[model samples]
Target: MKVCELERSLFESFPKVDAESWDHVGLSVGDPDSTVGRVLVALDATADMVRRAHDGGANVLLAHHPVYIAAPDAFVPRSGSHPQAAAAVFEAARLGVS
Candidate 1:
């Protein structure tokens, strides 16, 4: 299946998540939206990733790195604990993370 270019763009917009300085957001497989039939969201979408998407009938995986570097203290609306905390407040309105 053909993954959408738009979905790849979403990955590009993300800030460097890894703080170890030795790893990258590795994707050894296909593109982001490879004809996705479902989606999963998690701190590091693993089995939990598939579970979320699988149960929801989605094939997409949306994961946030646990060690993913974030600038919660920065001016940018960072995808850090602050945003995560805020999201926990309202499951209906999830904001964008960069």
Candidate 2:
């Protein structure tokens, strides 16, 4: 099956494993519009994940965790960055494109 299809199917099959009642988890990105030349599998999404995806020649990221939740106001990103920016920063860039 295609990657997106696989992602959705996998998420559906084991939603709780990838996430908990208080956690975020699911396919964050990977639209059909995406070229998807490469994929970066990560534990979390961060600016560093973006850089890692780019460096590893991955244009797409297949994160095990999900994005967007009910209480986002409490977990804001570092500026326009993603919530995982604090951890992604370990390998992310200052531009915060992630």
Candidate 3:
């Protein structure tokens, strides 16, 4: 299935409306139209998790917690500020893993 279809299924099971106003509950990265080969579920979108997902042939990485609570001004690896999020997002994008 496509990423959008999977996202729709997830939202149907856990409606976005049920989440808090400040919660980031939807897709944080990747193309909605991209085909999903596999899914890697985790608690956080850490760099290690992204690597595991990519290595395992998963096109999407479904994480309970988002990479960042708020969008960072820049996604720079080892930026000192929000390093984990930055690295995760950067690696995911680089490797074509959501």
Candidate 4:
């Protein structure tokens, strides 16, 4: 399934509007046009989790909590801030996971 299609499906069941105003829900990383054959769901998208998802052959990752949370710089590993989360984000992007 395509990433956009998967987003739509997830919203149908758990609408983004349903999420708390402070919550960031939906695809965190990856291209919308990308295709996914398998998905990995987790509460947090930690560096370890990202590696596991890639190693396990999961093309998409459905996370309950937002990794950025209004902090865009947190996803940059080279920034030396939020390294673990950044590692996860970078790894996920490298693996083409959403």
Candidate 3 structure quality by residue, lDDT tens digits, 1-98: 99999999999999999988888778887889999999999999998999999999998999998788787777767556666888888888888986
lDDT of 2: 0.54
Report residue 69 deviation for candidate 1 (angstroms): 13
Tens digit of per-residue lDDT, candidate 2, span 1-98: 45566566766888757566767554444444334466667776766677778777766666666444442443333555545544343343332222
Q: After TM-score superposition, what is the CA distance of residue 64 in candidate 3 from its true location, in Å?
A: 1.0
Q: What is the lDDT of residue 72 in candidate 4?
A: 59
Q: Judged by TM-score, which candidate is best?
A: 3
The 10-residue segment of model 1 with minimum total lDDT is 89-98
Candidate 3, residue 14: the lDDT equals 94
All models, RMSD in angstroms = 11.8, 5.7, 1.2, 2.0
Clash numbers, per candidate: 9, 4, 0, 0
Give all TM-scores, in the order shown. Answer: 0.42, 0.51, 0.92, 0.85
Residues 1-98, model 1: lDDT tens digits:
43455355655776446335754353322344456554456666333344445557654555565323342242222244455323321221121111
Q: Which consecutive 10 residues in model 4 have the weakest lDDT in total? A: 71-80
Tens digits of per-residue lDDT for model 4, 1-98: 79999899989988888888988677778899988878888988876787788889988888877766674555654355565667778888877777
Clashing pairs for predicted structure model 1, backbone only: 17-68, 17-69, 37-59, 38-58, 38-59, 38-60, 39-58, 39-59, 39-60
Global lDDT scores for all candidate models: 0.42, 0.54, 0.86, 0.79
